[model samples]
Target chain A: MKFTCDTKELSRACNTVSRAAATKASIPALEGIKIDIKGKEVRLCGYNLELGITTMLESKGDSEEDGSVVLDAKMLCNIVKKLPNALTTIQADKKSTVTIKSGDSEFQLVYIPADKFPELPKIDEKSAISIPQAVFKEMIQQTIFAVADDAAKPIYTGALFKVEDGGLTMVGVDGYRLAKCHESIDYHGQPFDCVVPKKALLEISSLLDESGDKAVDISIGLRHAAFMIGNYEIFTRLLEGEFLDYEGAIPKSHATEIKVDVRTLVESVNRVALVVSEHLRSPIKMHVGNGQIGLSCATSIGAASDTLDANISGDDLLIGFNHKYLSDALRNAGCDEVRLQLNGPLSPMVVLPNSGDSFVFLVLPVRLKAG
Target chain B: MKFTCDTKELSRACNTVSRAAATKASIPALEGIKIDIKGKEVRLCGYNLELGITTMLESKGDSEEDGSVVLDAKMLCNIVKKLPNALTTIQADKKSTVTIKSGDSEFQLVYIPADKFPELPKIDEKSAISIPQAVFKEMIQQTIFAVADDAAKPIYTGALFKVEDGGLTMVGVDGYRLAKCHESIDYHGQPFDCVVPKKALLEISSLLDESGDKAVDISIGLRHAAFMIGNYEIFTRLLEGEFLDYEGAIPKSHATEIKVDVRTLVESVNRVALVVSEHLRSPIKMHVGNGQIGLSCATSIGAASDTLDANISGDDLLIGFNHKYLSDALRNAGCDEVRLQLNGPLSPMVVLPNSGDSFVFLVLPVRLKAG
Candidate 1:
């Protein structure tokens, strides 16, 4: 394609599409970003089968010849990034090679034939539902970390999204711990439930931060989901499986309760875990009694213990848990003080922010072998 | 040992020794830091055979007894790093296990026997020479980058130091590029020529900063070199081989000369090199003539060209060079404008700072094959 565009606009479009371009894809054309110019706008698209990103820029008081070429994203970016800030003009010769010219410099880069590019599934923009960008990003941060990375359990590989008449709840569980959060939204009575892959959510979160004063338009299709933020649109295949019933796994009662300073508890547990064996099961015991809570990790090689004075009540008891699972939950809770409810040493413990139970973190305690 | 010391002092000592302790060493003892207590001071030592560091801290107004033990550097550092600001006490029991008590936390860590710790070599203080910390650090930086990394050339793996009555000069070469710098020292009549290992010079440079108030004492023994800076001492073995005669490699005359702004030249060539084939014998060709320099790189697939104005005084000439070697020298030349001296397309070109030849960088040009 022959076009003269602002360097900033070109650079931003290249960066957004390059994220979906796989560095080591078996298909050679997948490594190239497809560029197409038709009416008054130019569009760039990149796809790796699993994920795709497409972005467009409209001409400002200008018009260019309608043409298309698929240039290597990596080499084009390197050249544009190194050139001094200025307007850049790119043109395709009769031989089908692209030339980028700026100041006294000219670069000829080979391009893959645009016809070889895979066809991207068309997304209907009219069926989209818009949500506040801030709320959407926060929900992903709150629940995405708990998603299991192992693909053996396909359902747990993605975050479960449940949307009803009033609100939306997102839940993620990795067998050891579970994180769940809910956000109220203004929507019609369109009810839906789907599991969105963690990879798609992660990429969406990275680009959402820059969408200030703008909303994220999300559309759910029969088999694919699309998120449109700013000039960029990201699409991915919807996960096909049933998620676990996380509500049935959360504990309801407790035998001992303690309220602790969130920062103090997280730092103490992380320090003690440094000496814990990585191969063996990680079990850190917490003794709640009187007016204090004691955190302890005992191993065959060594032991570490830290005591924090807190407001603890109920029966005196000791509970063991996976150190990482508890820390992740406490950090994500986002509260000054957190109240931990323990039923017994063998049951899962419920960790709740002092303010409310809207965000709950549940950790399955490790069973300490009887001496 | 039972002693309470300032947290900052203990942390600094631990960090200095931990640098020498490699986590992937075959010998387990080498992974631990040896802590010895005697008189009013506590000394910590860590080594990995190739290099070693020792740091000492004297006890302030604290209650304690005397003992010796070796603790895992990585583990101890992790615990001490997380502790809040306060003095910490380390106590050893009859069972020989150590307890670190900081604030409300206590960590019991297993230690290797002190007798198994390797002993650091002793260098005579009489064979020492004192130099300004800033000057010594600068000398190492000017030459260390040119040292060859290939194990095949044992002599080129170190910086050659030529010390005489007038002053001292250091030179290093990696077959393609050479860097040499000279500094005035306080050495007397006796002259000494030795090759200091590149690893040792790098450590010494990082340890010594631009503080004219302090001095770095270098003691050259028969087998090892020791550098004592403040309360820390570092030891490294010297390379046992003769360095190449660098003087013969430097050209006595030139056929063409050009003076250009260092920043502009480096940036332009760097951009053009992006399109050049990496690790290839012929990377880029420079055509220098009347007041303008043109750089071009062409592969079987594509080509890029750029031109920049320069102050030229000689006839037109063309030279081929590995773009990376030229870029490295230009980046580290530390000058606003550089004067390039060239003999021919086959001879090495010398790049020097515009003012004087205090620092010299020479790059051997690549020989182009006939078309």
Candidate 2:
């Protein structure tokens, strides 16, 4: 096989696909990226059973070679990344040895037979629905960070993707906190619900930023999902487990309420968190009363307290929390002001944007020991 | 202790000193930064037995109160880092409770009594010698990276600082490589040779960058050396040992000579080094002849080769080396062209800048097994 392509184009494609390649897979072929060429078109694919990513591009150098080869993903990607910004030509023999030539640099890398490479899961195109990339990316960001990182809690390992009529809602929960976000789309397909692994959503969000005005085409199957954005096609196996009733977990009524600037609250909590971080429990306390909220934290290392201006008109109460949980929700609120509703000192509090977009963030207060 | 200062200035001082604070020192007081105040002058000091860094700053906000307090270095630094970019006032009571106020944000922190703070070493001004900051920084960079990191080889843990007749020579040697750099300065003190620990030199270089045209004042005592640069003062206990005879390690004659572009050699060697990195012992082979030099490396993972144009007039021969040693020396050569002198395949090779500067870098070659 012989093909020539633009250095930058090849470099970008290699980087995108290599993210899915397994570094310590039991099967050696899983460590290689399969390159297939047909009629001046080249497709690079990487898969590790759980997740797969592929990108298709034209040869640019006008080569019409038709063949396939699997080369070490890291070796090929690093070479392309360092190659001079010029046209690059790659040639491989029947023995599966590939040579990459660009400017005055030439690299020879051994490869595994393409026949042993795993095939990406097939997508059911008839059930595909397209959503604006901006809205989809925003929804993912507002909820993904709340997902639990512990593998033992498999039910909370992924975000729930529930689509109905023309609206999509994503929910992420880790018992301590829950984030639910909704975005309207122009879709009329049959409603579906699936849990997607957090790792796949993170990779998708990273590549979606460059889509500009483009829309992402998503198709959901019984046990798999596929997302196509720009020239990249990403497929992943859905997380199979029962999801929690997040709606029931959120408190509906509150005795105390406060409307505060998101940026102000984030900064104050961040500073107080620094003091509390000395202790692993991270006890940052907030007292909502009068026209301001007092944020404070005290540990064996030191103590810090700060007051931020806010609009308050409910019962006066004090609540303690893991500062990280509160700061993260405020920063991701994506609005100038946010409304915080608290039922009591021990109840879960809800934070929502003041502009009336459909986003609900709930955080359970950490129980403080009596001083 | 009471002091008012610009938030940014205080933040910079705190960060510089925090680098020396111990994270888990047996003495808890070592984890704190001692803040001493006199009139409008403020000094921030952090020391962990082995190294000490202190910076003096004029209080941007005038405060006549004078006393001292010791606060958790990391906590205070983090709080100041996030504080509003405005004038900040820090006041401490005799009970060691401190209050920091800036704009709408106020923080209260507990501190340790200043009496527990370690005393800084005193420097004798009569034995002090000054060197241009830029020249000293360059000398450190040229030789420091060659120092051995193994504590077992204590003799190679620091650079030998040799001064005579206003000429300064710093030498660093690991078992496999040696680097010597010389800089001429205006000094008339008694000649002295001391080994300065690597950690101290690194911290000194970081602060010297901002010392534009100023000179660094260096004072060496029996067991300690201090460097004062602009607003920062750094002190450290010297490494007590006999330095290796680096001059005897360099060969005086060679059978081959090649003058090559530094950038080209660096890029080619860097790329070939990637292919051979899978093996512990790097074996990048260079064959010099006619008008070009061919660099290549081969391992079970892959093989890479590139040819760079060079000015060669000596015997055509091949030599192998751990490309890292060569690439690092070339990267630090600080010249457009570099000349390589080789004795044989098994002998050490010397690399020098083509512009005839006082720099000598030597790297021993790796032995190749029979093919």
Candidate 3:
């Protein structure tokens, strides 16, 4: 079959779809991306049994014939991207050798039989929920870093996504710290909650339309969820097992409330953490006074202390926490002003943006040594 | 001892001097950077026995006393950078704990006795030569990448620097390729050649001011060479061995001459190398025709061919070369139009800028199997 396509368009499709292709898998078919040509359109699909990505591209030339073949995704994408950005023509033979030519460059790539390719499972679109690209991408970015990478607790590696009555909440936790992002969406369906693999959410966010004007349609099934953007659809498996009750874990009341600049806190913790982390105990201590909060860390190697101007109105308290946890929470607070609510030195600290009550991050403080 | 310094200036001095400090070395003193405080200037020095770096910073406040101590370089730099950029006061007690306070942040860094630090060797500047920073930096960038990284041949790991007859030449080579960069300098001293370690040259290049207006004073001794740029000086041990006769190795004539665009050839070779590298024999073949040169690489996995427009004269020749060698030579050729001179398939190919005779890069071609 002989067909031609725009070089830029083809390159983008190959790159986005290739992310789901299996690498170093035993099955040769799983390593190839299936490309099908019909009339003036070409459809490329990449599936590794668990995850699948499909993208459609409009060919710039008339198709002499219709055909299908599975070609190595990496080589094809590399060749296309390096070729001059001009009209590209790809012609495949019955012998499973695909010839790709653009400008003065030509590549003859061998392919796997198309029959060995796995088919993407279909999701019912009738009950699909639509989400604005910006809303969904931001939610994933705010919570994905908190997901656990440990295999010992597989349930904690996935984020719990819940949508009900125009409200959407994404929760991620690794026991040490929990990140929850609540945003309003245009949804009127029954309340449904699903645990999505963190890897899938990250990949989807990378492909999300950055303009935020586009809407991503999501169809959730019993075992799989499909996210459809402009000309592509990604299917990811739903993680099994019950999720944690993160809402109940958040502290309900606090005796101390201190408001400080988010940027200053992040920078201070990052600096003091350098010296603090060099010792046996990697904890940065926070002491609240009348109108200021002091952050200090002392080790055998070095000692650092930083005082930040804050509005503190509660009993003086001294607390110790892992510097990394505090830094991450402060960075993700996403507002100029951040509120730190504390019950005591032993309890978890609730952090929230000064302007928003919808989003909150809870961090468990490291226990201090008793005298 | 007590002194105050500009936060940014101190941070820069610490970072530049820290490049030569040892990390986790068997000798604990090598991991520390020595700071010497005098009347109104502070000197920071980091030495790893083979290499040494020294930087001076001006004190903002009058010094109450003079002292010297060695501290961890990375921690000191991190603290200085993260602290608020304002006037910073640093004071050290007899116990060797140095207190550094800037704005609202304070750090007390433990230090080792300054007597344990090695003294930087003095360089005689009477017979020293000066070179433009731009010319020296550019020469390093062009040839440093070709330096051998294999420890088996320690001599090839450094670029031979020669100053004679008003010509400054730097040569770097591996077994497969050699890069030579030459420029005119205002040096009329006795002819001398020394091998400067690639690492030392790279570090010196990083600290050189980009404006090119500043002159870098260089002093070469029997065993070490010193490069002084502004308030910073770097000294590195010279490699002891007879350098290779690279000037004699370059071909004086050629059987085929191919003039091609540097960028196009680089991109073409990069793309075709992907497919070529996937096979057992990773070599790209170049064929010179009348008005065009074809580049092709085929393996068991795939095949790619690209033809670029070139002005080819002399007998047509077919040659094979390692893609990396060819790409490196092309990238360092600098000029947009590059001339490729080939004597035979087994002979080394000389690549030069179409208009300049001062610069040359020689690439050894891989012998091809007889057809």
Candidate 4:
């Protein structure tokens, strides 16, 4: 394979696809990026069986022939990035030795035969949905943090995407907390739901453009899903299992409600958490009063207490919670103020926007020991 | 103990001393910072037996009594940094429980008795020298990288400071390479030599102001060294051993000399080193000719080569060196151009300034295998 391309473009493409390359694999070819040259077009692909990323760019120089080779992913990326910002040429000879030249520097590396590389799984475009890239990115960022990393239940490792009644809702739930976000879209097909692995969603989010209204087309297939963003295509396997009924698990009513500034509450929680270390895994205790919420934590090392003014309209109550869960929800609320709803000391606390119902975060409370 | 102080000043003082606090120590008090209050003066100290750092600041509030307490170093720094930028008051009750309050936040922590903290070693000022903080900082930065980290030979783990003939020289040498820097100082004191631990030099370097010509007083004693900068005092135990005779090891003559741009050579060396990883510990080979130097490296993974123009005088030669040692000296040369003198393929290569003799860097050659 012989082709010349801009060094910056090649470096970016290599970086974009290398996220899916297997770091350690039984198949040696799976740890490499396959480069294919046909006339003036060049395509680079990286795959690790479960996920694959492919990108294409036009070469700046004339190609000697149409051929392909697989090079080590990490080495290729590093070499291209460090090369001077000029036109770079890559050529592979019949002996399976590739030569890369730019400016006054040259590198010769042994390449794996292209025939040994595994092909990406074929994705059938059964149902397609198009949404603004920024909107989709926000939805993922707001909900993906609650996904469980445990492997015992595969479904909880991914976020559930549900499309119904011209609305798209994404839900991520671990055993301790649940995060859900919704956005309106123009759709007329039958309702559908699918679970996408967290890894794929994070990569897609990073590649999305936040300012422009560019659209990303997502197509769900029988066992795989494909996401098309500009000239790049990402394919990921659909996680197989039944997801939890998050709506049924969340509390429907609350006996106590408190309206408070999100930033104030988040800062108070962070301060209290300073004394809670790995050795002292203490829970933060909140005592809700008539006009303020007192946040405190006591461990063998130290004790910290903070107070924030809140508009409360229910019976006073005391609750205990894992500081990390509470802080995560407040930080992701993406609003100035929020309403916290509590049914009892042991029930889950629901957090919602002060005026709208676009997002809902539920955190299960930890039971406190008797004094 | 009771006093109020500016939060920013308190935080900065805590951070300044916490560097010497031990992360894990057999003595519990060594992991904490000692705070002593007398009248309106507040002093903070952190010592780990080998090194000690102390700083003093004036408190804002009137003191009720004079007392001292030791608080956890990490917790104190974190709390002060995160607290609101306002006046903060700290008070310890009769039960040795300390309460820290600022704005609407309060923290209560148990403190260790100040009597348990170890005292800093006394330094009898037998000889003293003062130099500009900026110049001293630069001298340390240029030579400290060559200090050996191996504990087997404790002498090589510190830098040798020699004061003689109205000049001060700092030398750092490992088995592979040596770095020496010299500066003329206005001093009339007995000539002396001492080895300061690399940890102490690093901390002193960081605390020195870079833009001013302010002087830092350094006193060398029989068993300890003291560095006084502004209101902070740092005391460190001297390493007792015979240092290497660096001047005798450096070559006085060379068969070949080449003048080259420091930036260009550094860039080329960096590019070639990319292919030499931990698994492929290959040395870079340089071939000098009439007007240019060619650098190349080959391992099982790949081969890279580059050429740079230079002014060569004397016989043509070939040499090999570990890329890391070569690059470190070149990058810290602090000049645009450098002169490289080589005796033969097996002798040490000396890197000198193009115009002056203020600095010298020597790197030993690695023997290459015969083809």
A155-179: candidate 4 lDDT, tens digit per residue: 9999999988698999999889999
lDDT of 3 by residue, A189-301 (tens): 88888888887887899988767489998898888899998788999888888888987999888999988889988888887776765336767899998798888888877
* Alpha-carbon runs more than 4 Å astray in model 1: A58-63, A124-127, A210-213, B124-127, B211-213, B277-282
Per-candidate local distance difference test = 0.82, 0.86, 0.85, 0.92
| Top TM-score model | 4
- Among the numbered candidates, top DockQ falls to 4
**Model 3, docking class:** high
Q: What TM-score does model 1 achieve against the real structure?
A: 0.95
Prediction 3 TM-score vs. true: 0.96
TM-score of each: 0.95, 0.95, 0.96, 0.98
| Candidate whose lDDT is highest | 4
Give the candidates in order of lDDT, highest first. 4, 2, 3, 1
Clashes of each: 0, 0, 0, 0
Candidate 3 segments exceeding 4 Å error: A124-126, B124-127
In CAPRI terms, where does candidate 1 land?
medium
Docking class of 2: medium
Tens digit of per-residue lDDT, candidate 1, span A131-207: 78877887888798789887678888889888777778899998888889887776665788878889889989988
DockQ of 4: 0.87
- Show where candidate 2 strays beyond 4 Å: A60-64, A368-371, B60-64, B104-106, B124-126, B278-280
